[model samples]
Target: MYAGCFLVLSLISFTIQTETAVYIQHRMGWNKAYCMLYFTHGSWSLLWPMQLLILRLQKWNVPWQPFWRRHVAILRSTAQMIQHRTLHLTPRQSQQSPLRYMIWTTAYVTCALTVAGGSWYVAVDMTTASDLTAIYNCSAFFAYVFSIPLLHEKVRFGKVLAVAVAIAGVLVVAYGGKAEESTPKHGGKSGGGAGGPDHDAKEPQNRALGNIVIGIGSVLYGFYEVLYKKVACPPDGCSPGRGMLFANTFGSMIGFFTLCVLWIPLPILHFTGLEKFELPTGDTAKMLLVSVLANATFSGSFLILISLTSPVLSSVAALLTIFIVALVDVMLPGDLATPLSGNAIAGGCLIIAAFIMLSVATYREMDEERRQKEMEVAESEVDEDEA
Candidate 1:
């Protein structure tokens, strides 16, 4: 039941976030990751509070009065912990709103999306949009590796095989899925070149570099995801509703850092002629406004999935976005559409098969766990009657 709910929600959220961001960068003329990061991070700030307030109305534990105060304290403590390399949680603190949990959320926002999101948008400039998304999702295998030790999810053959399958699929999509329309030969008179951003990004070398950077971002994001499961949404007593509220609130806080740190570097980079850091204006700003809203909901929904399901499931679920985004890019009336390739189709199939395999393995574990609990309950009843 939990898995089903999570799967559906994850699919929607991942699709919305990936497709919107790619569309803005790849299709529309707005490709500033710095601007995108501010909006993306701010989206959480926009969303989590409203959801928390809703929970409060429903009688869930929503800290109202001093919550913002504690939020500030958490930020300061996290900064201190970073500087001193000293952070610990007491047993009681472990159960409540701990600085560790908030810290991890900030780390995820900065490391995963802020960093990864930036790389991903830049990647869009170089590679085909679909290919960029597909390759970046190769993070599933990275998450799988970290899950074993961090999540204590047992290493099983089926799960391992699934990871291998998905990785192969992503590679196939990245390299051989060469859309007929992707190269000049496939260019249509409709003026939809599919590599629409800047003409220079269409270079083969730039595509290669984009792929490398996106892949690196994926690895780091995978780490962020597994740690989120293990640290933020522990299986002991946390619920999706509760974790969503806290995780997202902490995530929103990262926007503050982005506002501060990313701001300073923009002028430095601009003045030094390193990279152009232009603020969004007009249509670019409008697109960012809409995209960030999607991002906020995306973060909220993603955390809910992680809390209800495993990190591996959440990661694998994102693979579906590649197919969905690719289809949209191809079908939509725009130059951003890369021609759909046979290899990409094959890759998508392989990835879907991998998802099924992982699902089956997870179900088997759940069955065994259910049986063990039932047996324990029965034995306890027997002892009670015997007494």
Candidate 2:
């Protein structure tokens, strides 16, 4: 059941990411600063809706709460109810361990910092939608690298080799030169009237800076997943749902506070008419709305998926997001043209292959562990009966 849910979550995430990329490409302007701000606030805003829904459901007799206090209340009520109905043994459960809290705190802090820094940098620097997608895709590489050491997870050799191929594909997509085209106006003067043809090129320096910022942010976020898996999955008597709910609440609070601190100087700078930040225009508003919804859904579902399964599987499944985005880019009108170079195709195939190999290897390992545990249980029963 959990595995099926993860697959569904992955598909939903892919759809949302693809739509976000399209919206950014078409409706949103090329201002990195405004884009980053929109994404930052949008992501934080999702917590309110999620919390409201959870609270409402809980009030209506939903057995969803899993945190310290809530879990105790739930167990106590359940015990009382059962005791009234019939006679049975009552078992006591231990309190949540300190290590779990520490892991959650650490993951939340790191993720918040990463999102703030990355979004700010991207907003200031990125000029094109394709650049944004390419940079975002780098998260997979980071995830692959960070998961092994941080989570004590193992990866197959084929998976490593596939990651290299995927990286190569990214280079082809990023640096493979494409012809510049004029921006299409919807219903206005065909060309510049008073001024000659407008050809304001984005500064190379700003673009480079944006890439660096988003890149680092992606790496931090990649590790964030591994950390979440560790903290959310306790050895015994821990509720994954409750842990996630708390993490989201705590993380969002931290994010909101950080954004407030970060935005403090923005108003001052805007007052001086120096930074000159304004709300997005035209399709930008629509894009922001879609991106926000998609991001929130994917993020919430992803945490649930992680709790239900292992981090390695979640990470591997996440790689499919790239394929989804790329496919969407091809299918949508006005989407960026994917260059059909030999290297590009080869690189894409390699990344897909790598994800498949990793998934298979991880599944085999899990199955083996399950079989071993079953065998041990059977042996114990046999010895008891003989005695």
TM-score of each: 0.74, 0.65
lDDT of 1 by residue, 15-92 (tens): 555555555665566655554555566556656467556656765464666665665565444433333324554444
Q: How well does candidate 1 match the true structure in TM-score terms?
A: 0.74
**10 residues in a row with least lDDT, candidate 1:** 184-193
Each candidate: how many clashes? 0, 2
User: What value does the lDDT take at residue 321 in candidate 2?
Assistant: 54
Instruction: Give a tens-digit lDDT track for model 2, residues 250-277.
Output: 4454345545445565677577864566
Q: Which stretches of candidate 1 lie over 4 Å from their true place?
A: 1-6, 26-28, 56-109, 119-135, 179-213, 260-262, 334-339, 377-387
lDDT for position 55 in model 1 = 52
Which pairs of residues have clashing backbones in candidate 1? none
Worst 10 residues of 2 by lDDT: 186-195
lDDT of 1 at 251: 53
| Top model number, TM-score | 1
